[model samples]
Target: MRISVKLASICLMLVLLLTITTPAFAATTNPVLSVTGTTVAPVASVTPTTATAPLMPGDTGTVVVTLTNTLKSPGTGNTTVITESHQNVYPPTAGSGITTTRQTQTSSSDGSSGACELKFVNLLSEGPIHVQNAAYTDVGYLGLGDSAQFQFTIKVDDSAADGKYYLPLKVKTDNDECYVNQVVPVVIDSTQPRLVLNDAPSKLGTSRGNIIIDVVNYRSSGINSASVIPEGAEFTFKPRAEYTVGSIGAGEMYTVTFETSSKNATYTGNPSFVLKYKNGDNWHQTAPLVVGMEPKTDAAAAGNGGGDNTLLILGGVILVVLVLIGGVYLFMRSQRSKK
Candidate 1:
């Protein structure tokens, strides 16, 4: 009977030890306790909603980009995936202190990967507004539950045609093959005429010279009565003050000649031509096209030379008179000495 009781006591100790250790084994074996959260792909969206345009060529402006993170549960382990997915995402999170590289936008239409890409770059001191093989500015690091608005500086190509043109914006993450191509509207000012100083004479003749003026109508509509107002006191033209040109077609060149003359011998000033043109019954005038006029005349130099010649002639007469007086005195002295 005593042996049986000892066996029972051993069994009871085994049961107590199992009760304490069983909870620990269950905690280690249960997979739910090990994994605290779930991980999924990064969910984010970038939209270029509004664009401001009608900007002049050779001018710079800004484009706004809206970024939002739509991820419900962003995973810790997938942070790298999220960040790498938005490698081209721009204007990194505040204080994240991340720097990104400038990239070019490529067109699948042509096989030239980044060569002919249209991209926006920092404006250099001297260069074309649109850099070759580059497209839009990259805004880096768009994160979950975060919204960012980024302003991108862009330049309109000087040679870009009037009317609305769209610049393609491409956003992609290196981690995935997904990319978004958003087109932004760019409008070039179509109403203004580009008045370029095509040609001019180096020197205006004393009486008259031909001032060649070119009216380049780059607008869609033609211009009428394209004229130049040569307004200055020092100069005069055939017509009182205005030189009228008939009409100029769109994208056409009209060369008008003005018979300009300088009034004074010594005139050193800019002879300005105010460009006046009419478009659809509305008159428009451009800033003065000031041409440097330095009147060329030998008359001024000849007048000074004539004064010198007069003084020389007077000197020659006095010299002749003095020689005669000396000769007479010498003859009188010779006669006195002989007597």
Candidate 2:
């Protein structure tokens, strides 16, 4: 009986000791092996970022990066604290509109030892172009069932050029980390249309002898004559009527004239004339007159010289005939008197 009592006491003592230490082991169901995180996008924000469009220049925008934990802790279950940080990855080239911003974790502490936790932050990066906001943080004090959520935002500048941009992000939990690679393309429009002149005028004048011209349309089906300058400058040829200039079909031509009084860059000789036709979106040029040139003369060439001699000779011949007739008449009169 004595031996049995001693053995019972020893068994009781051992049981009590085991129970005290066992609570700690029993408190934890499992041991946490690793930490992992993934982004949980709000149902409306499946893209993770606020917008997927290429960021506009001089514009402000936002993005959301989500992080999650992969492993659950053991024994004591997971009682862990988690934090998140953010960074920007600019385009590969310097001066690229692409840039980045680091978001400070807006919040991270929750007393609950549960499966869910989230961190929200505001991020900013300025300049024109495309860039990204990456939530990079790790699971801290991971015991059992440790997890975290990281959310951040970013902005793109309005002066950014158009092209393809790349945004790379990374996610971290405790000691483990993962990389996220994304590409965002930015497009820019900076080209202007060109306007060229098909025909140019070299002179401007009032007379027909200087320049004669045939003008035509340059770019489209027509041009506006209302833009004609120096209004009412004695136009010999009708530009609007002849060319249908307001509707000057492409490749169509019209005629105009220049007077003899026109001048060249070097000479103002009245012997020549020039016609100028300037047409353009900016209305910027003059063409040389293609008209024929001719010399001018007045009425002084007639009414003088050798014509007086011929009149005198004809008058003398008529006088001789009259004298002969008169003598015959006198002879007849004497015969009659003698008889």
Candidate 3:
């Protein structure tokens, strides 16, 4: 009975020893192996920047495009399970003991793993828009949360109408792994105010005379900084350089007068007038209007000549009457003396 009790105590101690040492052996024998999973694809956001909106036709400017990688680091977790079995004999006794142990350890990491490679970037020109620069190639890699900027020079054709236009943007990666095709919108504004010369002086006298001109705005929009510039080869005009008319509303009419005199008595050259105004932020001038100016020198000279001739004729008649009356008085005196 004493032997049985001692054996039982010895077995209990062996079991406790095995339990403590088995965990330490398993920890050293097994190591956590990290297995990387598939990486998430990168998605880029594109933003375009322009200097001005509603650009006028025949304008040149730059377009800057920013590409941002919006993808984040991938999350990963790894788990390792270790199973160990051991057999132990305490005192070479008939009864032996067997022990089994299991250990589990997990390791994880949430970090950046992937990047975006841009092989080519291009901005294509469409109708009435031309690209002035070459396409970009081998732009390089962009990691998560990374961004890049590309600048392009562009020009709008002079014949482009007033409307909205789209420019195609092409982005590509190696072996066509990632491709993106998008469009950027641009506005074209080519509207201009229309000005017409309604009326102008048809004749000018030799002396200082008034040159009246009627200006009419034909457009529905208002025109600012309205002015008129008169040009003549044979005449000198008031406000020799420019005549400011201020502003004119839609479909409005404004009359301006200039004091002018002919340089010579006969003006054979044609006179012209130009209308200058501003639309939005651009200044425009209309084609010169050739106005006919007839000089009144011939009529004035004829009237003066006729008046001088009439005065001479009246003087001659008075002189003839005086001479006849003198002769008659002298004859009557002679008759009276003879009587």
Candidate 1 deviant stretches above 4 angstroms = 1-191, 194-201, 295-339
Q: Write down the TM-score for model 2.
A: 0.24
Residue-level error in angstroms, candidate 2, position 46: 18
Query: Global lDDT for candidate 3?
Result: 0.64
Estimated TM-score per prediction?
0.36, 0.24, 0.50
User: Model 2: per-residue lDDT, tens digit, 1-339?
Assistant: 756865654565454334221111125332222223223111222343333432333433334443333434422442333233333335554323343433232222223342322222222332343335543433344334444344444434535665544444433222222222342233322221122222334443444333344454443223334122111223343332222224344456655442323322222222212222222221222332233223122221122223555667777777777787778888999889999
Write model 1 residue lDDT over 177-267, tens digit each, in one string: 2244445454556466645566667766567877777767776546667887777677777776687776887689876677777776656
**lDDT tens per residue, model 3, 83-125:** 3334445455554444343343433333224466788888899
Summing lDDT over every window of 10 consecutive residues in candidate 2, give the lowest-scoring window.
295-304
lDDT score at residue 99, model 2, on the 0-100 scale: 36
Which candidate achieves the best lDDT against the true structure? 3
Error of 2 at 13 (Å): 4.1
Candidate 1 to native Cα RMSD, angstroms: 24.6
Full ranking by lDDT: 3, 1, 2
